[model samples]
Target: MTHAFYVYASYGFAALVTIVVTVWTWADGRARRRELAALEAAGIRRRSARPKDSLGDGE
Candidate 1:
């Protein structure tokens, strides 16, 4: 096998891996958002979403 073949194959594999990871991350984010929405609809809330006054933090 030639050096050029190896280099191109390596680059192709790297690009394929990058694309796969990007797609997976995007999909996972969408799923998480959906779950969060469902939880919010069920009256569960995130602490960060609450008003600071409700947290009893000293000003």
Candidate 2:
């Protein structure tokens, strides 16, 4: 194979990998957001929503 063929193949492979990762991340994020929304709708609250203790020590 020619040097040009190898270079183009590598570039194409990299691009394909990047696209796959980006799409996977986007879809995962959407799924997580939907799950969170459903949980909230079911009346579940995050830990951060609760009031903290006055003491500086960690509880």
TM-score for each of the candidates: 0.89, 0.83
- In terms of lDDT, model 1 sits at 0.95
Over 1-59, each residue of candidate 2 has an lDDT whose tens digit, in order, gives 99999999999999999999999999999999999999999999787776577445675
The TM-score, computed over Cα atoms with residue i paired to residue i, of candidate 2 is 0.83
Per-residue CA lDDT of model 1 for 1-59, tens digit only, reads 99999999999999999999999999999999999999999999998899867877653
State the lDDT at 31 in candidate 1: 100
Instruction: List the candidate 1 regions with Cα displacement exceeding 4 Å.
Output: 57-59
